[model samples]
Target: MQGFKKAFAEQLRLALPSQEVTLERPKDYQKGDLAFPCFKASQSLGMSPQSLASLLASKIKIKDATIEATGPYVNLRLLESVRSRETLASTLGNYPLPPQEKKNATILVEYSSPNIAKLFTIGHVRSTMLGHALANIYAQEGYEVVRLNHLGDWGTQFGTLLAAYELWAKDSNPELEKNFPWAAEYSSESTTPLHRLLQLYIRFHAEEEKNVSLREDARAWFKKLENQDPDARRLWKKFRDLSLIEFNRIYERLGVTFDSLEYGEAFYEDQIPGVLNALDSKGLLKEGENGSKVVDLSEEGFDIPCLIQKGDGTSIYASRDLAAALFRKSKWNYERCLYVAGSEQNFHFQQVFAILSKIDPWFKNKQTHVPFGLIKLPEGKMSTRKGNVIFLEDVLNEARDRIQKIISAKNPELSNQAATSEMLGTGAVIFINAFNDRNTSITFDWNKVLAFEGDTGPYVQYAHARICSIFRRAGGSWSQWAEPRSEDFGRLHFESIELPKSLQGLDHASAQHLIFELNGLEPALKASAISLSPTSLARQLLTISKAFSVFYNDSPILNVEQSEAIRQSRLLLCLATARVINQGLRWLGIFAPTEM
Candidate 1:
């Protein structure tokens, strides 16, 4: 289809040698398959748009297409023969997508950096799915995509948790109480460890309000952890390991995988002294109150100092981020690195990137902070210390349970009950986050996400299942189409097949509309990939799904009034719709079910 458009554009050049011609799909199909507006050029040529359009329309002569002058535009209508089964061959291999502009280009996408002791909150879901989709889209464009989970494993918060654990949790594990007085009940079983850890964390924050000395105690324990004291190191390692096990369970359900995991703050702990010393040597580090180290940014448009290290000589986030950025450049030599964080950290990331650029002028513009909007529940924003956050795992489990009930009541005879429910539920959760623009704040609405009758994931999935049923029934009745070694049902790569003798005589408008949308997949793929938004492709898939549903209803596939040839042609259309829908859905990290 892309080649055909290019060839048609080249033909237009011959007709109007002095014109810069661009072709567009008309809003109304009756206008034309492709329309070119003559008004812009005609004004400079001192001629009316209608006259120029008519003149150009007369001069144009192409095979298997007709030209017409409609008001101020020139329209082109392709013959059925011009867009036959052979036209779809590009979608099979690599016909649709153009060659990669830069081969072996590496990109690191860092996202879903949930803290070690906290549950995976709803906000993590947004950043995680966004990064996952971007990685997939980048990979399709031939980039060496690396999905990095920059975990938040080291901070003052860990100190608070340790202090809390030492005070309240040491007695829970009597054996550990004797050997290591600070370690909590490190449950080998995954279920209770996270809950106990979060409880201790909350308790520490609540107690810190009444007892002022607890803050210093928390700071002291964190300083010990930072110094890698043997006892503190053991507990920190235990907390990190158990937390990962629970996190992986959630990620597995979402189908999100990481190529590299880095504790950015922790990974740079050793490099902190060297980095700070370099800053001092470069005259960037300055002394602050109470024996603290800071970098004055007044000249750089900041009123406060960017603290490199706290008064107690413990490194802050900025110091560690500088080390991590240099380390990544040395390790991957990546052309581009994206930090997919929340918008709440906008100023902090801005400070980090700005200071990194000032420290080394060569490191500017190569890194991006793609801060996404925060997801708010109906209640409001979440706070882990207050214990008011809605857990992502709980929401996913609820979605799965609801879908299983739907399947039981609606699709009782379906054999793949377990798999089907998961596919639908997971697809529901992913689709809502992906279909919304990344930079826009959106409320979590399970009603809209799970609706089967509207513009929702289940609606599209059912459309796929509907197409599969049509094909299955048609294949069984007409064994000729499914002859052994001649055809298969794994995937319908039917672009090269000759049009059946019966389908040659059909010219229904519904069939034409379906064909037009199918031809647009290649351009849609390029648009979605280049714009760095899967929502473009998502919206396109939804368009195709809705169109197919309309076509199926208007044109009967197995009605007694229709001939066998008509039935075959409609079935062929159904196959084409299913292929594009399935392919497009997968591109957006959605699963299309064969049966709902």
Candidate 2:
């Protein structure tokens, strides 16, 4: 469908010269397959839309394409053999390979950024899954994609934690000792123990509220740390190392990897100075209360001012982001930069882009935010502060356990292939999240995500596996079923095949449907990459699977009449369909198993 649209669009450009023609699918399959409205061209050609369509219908002849006029629209139908063969060749021959032109574009994708000392929640899954999928999609398109884990490693929260640790170390608490063994013993006889850490943190914040001096003290400590206080640096490195060890385990289970690990803290020394200089040069910086520097964007309708430097002159998030962007641009010279973040920070990105635009207009349009919706639990919204969030590792493990049980019941013989089961289980989790449009709120439903049937990831994997089973039963290699040359196989007689005509009806209809759908891949990818919507690719995979189902049930490969040409032709088509499904699933970072 995509190829036909491109060809038709080009043909129209030549035919009308002065007007633009848009290709669309007819609402009803019975009204031909692809539709083109002639309304715009009518005025330019000095004729009614209907009349213009009629004129073009008479003059234009696309090889292997049937054209008809319906009211003000021109509908087209491709010769069955052409549609089948092209779809087959593209699927089987070109998949998993990038076009020569798109091979060099380098992309930096930052996602799944969970804060240190926080449990991996469903909210974290959105960016992680979405980023991984986008990276895969870009890589498939031949881009040298750099996956960066821009971890939230630096913040005032660490100071609070440190203070909490100090207070807790003064008192010996056994429960805290058990939970946080590493930080249990830090003080002398008056030392606070680990169990009372949370209470200590709360007390510290409460006192800071009433006593301005204590607040100033904490700020002073942070500044000292920022100014290369040896103790602060040592603690920061230890905390960062501990947090990453835990984070990497979750990432490994999710089958995600990053080309680099850059901490938010890493940019503090160099980034703060550069950003301050840039803001000062632009005259965008303004002093706020408590010695903090802020960028006032109230005129831009954002009530929240971006705090570049906090009170006591400590750098904040906005400053770090600005530094990161400048560093990335100068280091990689990326044509496009994407930030996969939660939608709650939509305004934050708007401010970031606006600030960058003021500083470097060239980067204004190039920087993009792919914001996704929050992941809510059944009870309500997840809160990391309350320690009420489901860990990502827990989700993956539960999925794997459930899959293992199902495998035990259905295919016990293959239980030894633990690696494959792990892949399928993890794939399901990714697909469940990726299947939806990224901006919509996702209610994590265990039943829906883990389902082995229906439109889930495992379902598609099963479908591919089923096809492979057919190839095995046939006792021959798929290559034995060569694609029929145009001369050898003339126009297909849909009725001549063993299956009922209605069976082919779906594929016949869907071949056109898929062609149109597949045609949107490039545009869809560009949109997804820009918008950070893995859901688009998810939807694409679903459509491909749906098309394959139609092809599978309607077309018979093994039991058809024993004519060598027809059998081979059908096999080639089936192989091509399978290839498309495999490649599409891969883009979503899901695996297509060879057997269920």
Candidate 3:
């Protein structure tokens, strides 16, 4: 289908050598599959749009398509047989996508930097999934992508946790130790070291209200950690290691991974001195209040300076970020580095990028902050210190439990019910996160995310499953077309069988609309990458699902009254729709189940 569009565009260009041709699909498919508006050309030619359209229509000719002039547009309608064959072949992976210019370049994406002692909350899902989707999209466009997780394993938050641990050790407070034991072993049990650290953290905050000296103690502990105190370093390493064990369990379920696990803030802590020395040598470093080092951005139109260090001689976020940026450029030489953080940190990124630009102008155009809006529950905001948070694992477990009950009621004897329920459950959560624009704040709703109908992940997955069921009812080797050997159901292989020659069964309006929607996958992917948003691709998948529903209702693929050739052709169309939906969902990091 993409090849056909390119051919049509070339034919139009040859007809109007003086103008750049622009093509669009009409709102109503009855007009044409592709339309060329002549308003701009007509103005330059000193003629009416209708007249110019007619002139171009008469001059242009495509091999398997009909060209017509309808008012100010030149519409091209593809021959039904040729359109069916081309569309099916494209969706079945017989056609190759056009070449990409960035095939030789690399992209670095950093995201999901949750703090060490906190649980993975619903608020962190936006950045994690959005960054994952964008990285997938970039790889699809032929760029070498490097996934990074700039962990929040440093700073005063760790100080508070360390202080709390020392203040309430197992020997000092037996009551607190009973609730959360400070054991050396870490496992998948409920009382892991991470959970104990979180409880200790919350208790410290709660007790700080009555004890005014706890804040000072935390600050002092952090200063010790910065000065290479052996005890402080040992505890920090323990917390960091155990946190990764807990975080990786969630990442495993979500099917996410990073290229470099060691390139976090702590990894660049020792490099901070080099950054400060370089800035001081360049005369860019300034002395701010309280002996802290800073960079004045008054000429850059900012009221406040970028703090490079604290008054206590500890390196801060700006200094560490500068070092990370410099290391990425020297190490990976990425063409673009994307930081997927929340919108609230926009100013902090701006300050870091400004400093990079002043130090080296080449860094000006290479970095981007892919900011997303917040996600909240109906009760308002969540806070880690107050212990009013929802863990991601709990939400996923709840979704899986609900799906398991629904499957037991709907398909009592279905095989692999446990695995299918998990797939559908996790896919539902991922789809809802990707369905909206990146910057649109969402109040999480369970009904919308889990609905089997409407614009939901289950709706699209069910469409693929229905197609599989069709093949199952047909019996014999039909199941092999779905790639039964692979764990991923979307790894379809339908090209082994030849499509029926009598494709006149697909001439119906509904079938044509479905084919038209299938043709849009490539363009939709391009648009999603360009805008850095998955909403376009998600909506396109929903449109394909709706179109398939219409086609399924109006046409019969296996009725005895229909001829064998027509049934085979209709079945081929069904397979094509399933394959396209599966591919789109895979790119968004969602799975398409062959059964629901």
Best by TM-score: 3
The alpha-carbon lDDT assigned to residue 315 of candidate 3 equals: 83
Residues 1-596 of candidate 2 have per-residue lDDT tens digits of 55777888788778888677778767565566578898878877778999988888887777888988899998887676565555444444433222435666678888887776555666787898788888876765567777877787776766665654554443544334444332233222113222244334445666666786766556665676688888777866766676677778777777677877764556455678899999999998999878989998887777978888987778777888898888888888887777889889888899988888888887868777888888888898876544455656667767888888888888988735677677788888888788778878877777876776777888778767777777767666652322222210011011111221222322456455554444344455565655566666666667666766776677666887656565666555556555556666666767667775
lDDT of 1 by residue, 19-46 (tens): 8889887767556578889987799789
Model 2: CA > 4 A from native? 1-7, 25-34, 43-48, 94-100, 103-106, 140-144, 169-174, 177-221, 299-304, 479-531
lDDT of each: 0.73, 0.67, 0.82
Each prediction's RMSD to truth:
5.2, 7.4, 3.4
Worst 10 residues of 3 by lDDT: 484-493
What is the descending lDDT order?
Answer: 3, 1, 2
Q: List the residue pairs that clash in candidate 3.
A: none
Candidate 3 C-alpha lDDT tens digits along 329-401 = 8999889999999998999999999999998888988899999887767787677787666677767777888
Structural similarity to truth (TM-score) of each candidate: 0.86, 0.83, 0.93
- Between candidates 1 and 3, name the one with more favorable lDDT: 3
Worst 10 residues of 1 by lDDT: 482-491
Candidate 3 runs further than 4 Å off:
94-102, 170-174, 177-190, 209-212, 484-504
Query: How much is 192 displaced in model 1, in angstroms?
Result: 2.3
- Report the CA-based lDDT of candidate 3 relative to the real structure: 0.82
